[model samples]
Target: MITTHAAIEDNIKRYKRGELIVPSDFRGKGTENAIKKTLSRLAADGTIKRLGHGLYVLPKKDPLFGEILPSTEEIAIALAKKEKVKIKPAGAFALHKLGLTLQVPTKLVYLTDGNGRIIKVGKNTIRFKSTTPKKMALKGELSGLIILALEELGTDQIDESTKLKLSNLLEKENPIILKQDLKLASAAVHDFILKLILNK
Candidate 1:
């Protein structure tokens, strides 16, 4: 068996240059204490970042830009992956991603099938709100994003320009995927999406 220190070092190589690291990732790789010690050492040496309570990431650097920390969305997605859970960007973040808005919300929200938690990275605060499986059905789909953005702004708040923006976005999505996403949206949002795509 490899030594404790060596096991942690070898495991670090498994992550990509900018990938996030979580404890559960090495559950079976080595003894809990050994892995903890190894990771602590790396963090102290500035070889890796301690993002939060049990979150860490291999920081990426650019020659011109220097260190580039992971974005709130990236960190959230990584956490979901490590836990084998589903998470979809919600509210303002969704609208921003879909090109419907330019404002970046202070708090990034994600509807998740996993338990709720918050992770703070600099000025970005990532929040995971536990939601039902039904809501997470389209986690990675564009339609899911549309629904969240629409819900956040509300039907009454959707201006003509915003609707047009959504129309253009829907036009670019694969027809089959659009149909699948429509099936997963709420009834009102489903009708709205149909109207947008059909140009009605």
Candidate 2:
């Protein structure tokens, strides 16, 4: 007879390295306690790495980086997919995603329609902050991220080079979607984006 731990270990072998694993993935294979215990054991044995509470991944080894782990953004997006919720990059993370910032933040923040929580993965932290529906309803792919970054920086912090960078970034966005997203922006952001669009 296959032991519960053995069965789980075999199942984990089928997953690609770096794929996200959650308890729900093994729902019918064993009891909740059995699965959790087996997963903990796997993590302890270096077969898989525990990311946050209830999150695990099969470890991937890179020649230069040693053990390659998923980025914080990837983990948050995976969690949102599992929970069937929506998430939007916010604050410093938004800036970093837009290439407006050179340094990666130790704490990544996202706006979500679901419950807010914090999860620490190694030295970095992922924060999901509950936000209003309106903020989550942004239309453009790039425009929404730009709005978040600008809001975090505020109007006073924006400078000539920053505006130039934003204008260049805005060039790649769909004009219709960009215009639609501008309506959702704050007064300052709306005006700023409008000027960029017009100047384009």
Candidate 3:
């Protein structure tokens, strides 16, 4: 039988490296229950945080701000991979990527076609939205991100400068693969992207 303290130490070491582990990770040699108990104790001690269900992460500390660290989207991606689900940044994440917004979003939104759930890490929330993989793949990063930004910005937000920047970036990135689908996009999305490309 693995000792509770030893298991807790080992778990903390693994979590420090950005690994998310559950009781199953300790499944061998009849250590599952002991490991779960140890994990709960550690969580109560603030050595790690519970991210919902059986998910947990080692909290990172920010030196400059003297506070707990911000949520790492990479961790979210890794979690999705562990759950065998495909995910892409959406909403505020997409907005930030488009250079249209500078706010640090507290909620990490991901587009996925799989089951959706809300995960709480420390004081922040990470939300997964169930969306078709095609929609997730569409907008194709830069263009998609720009589209999301425009959606948040509304119709009048598609100014000449925003169009020029978006066009240049799209031309450089070349999201032509998304064009056919873009034709069927919302009127604002289709018109804005097409006009930017044509005008240039």
Using lDDT as the measure, the top candidate is 2
TM-score against truth, every candidate: 0.76, 0.83, 0.69
List model 2 lDDT by residue over 1-200, tens digit each.
78888889999989998888999888888899999999999999999999988889987888899898888878889888988899999887887888988999999998999999998888889898998887899977788999977876676777888788889999998988887888888999899888876886
Model 3 lDDT on a 0 to 1 scale: 0.68
lDDT of each structure?
Answer: 0.79, 0.87, 0.68
Segments in model 2 whose C-alpha atoms lie over 4 Å from true places? 1-3, 28-31, 61-66, 195-200
Candidate number with the higher TM-score (2 or 3)? 2
For model 1, what is the alpha-carbon lDDT of residue 12?
88
Error of 1 at 68 (Å): 2.9
Could you tell me the lDDT of residue 122 within candidate 2? 80
lDDT tens readout by residue for model 1, 1-200:
77877777788877787888876667777788777777888889988888776678898889999878787777888788878888788888999888777888878888888899888877778898898787777733566788877766666778899888888777777778778777777788888888887774
Model 2: lDDT to the true structure: 0.87
Q: Pick out the ten consecutive residues of candidate 2 with the lowest summed lDDT.
A: 149-158
What C-alpha lDDT, on a 0 to 100 scale, does residue 70 get in candidate 3? 27
